[model samples]
Target: MPWQHKIAYLIGKPVGISLSNGQGTSGILCDVSNGKLLVLEYLYQSQFALKQYDFHMIQDINGFPPCMSQRLY
Candidate 1:
């Protein structure tokens, strides 16, 4: 799927992201920049942090229900 379509569908939603490096994380999809970066707000060390991932490094993206996201915070 195209980035724009995926971005629009996932923005403001909780999602699980799998990266090419074999690492994964779940976070709220915050924004996209230059159509090549994804900004995700996630919990780290008991605090919420924003992280940016390169589009090409993402292997997959899955949406999680809002209820699941609530449990994180």
Candidate 2:
């Protein structure tokens, strides 16, 4: 499977998203796709809401897009 799809499997896991723009958003990895990510109860730029973000637009999946690392995203 592709790494993008691997991110989809992270549903229900907590993850911190770091964007290429130097912004970060943290929330439960509710859903993922080749094009986007759905986050629930997310905290970004001091804002709170449920929003879907583009995958390519993100710099990193804070805890690791797959959460396989010792330090979870």
How many steric overlaps are in each model, in order? 0, 3
- TM-score per candidate, in order? 0.69, 0.62
lDDT of 1 by residue, 1-73 (tens): 7444666788888888888899988888887777554556646576887888888888878788545435554
In TM-score terms, candidate 2 sits at 0.62
Instruction: Quote the lDDT for 5 in model 1.
Output: 62
Residue range 1-73, candidate 2, lDDT tens digits:
4446457556788777778789887888777655789888645587767788987777767444453557656
In terms of lDDT, the best-performing candidate is: 1
**Candidate 1 regions with alpha-carbon error over 4 angstroms:** 1-4, 44-46, 65-73
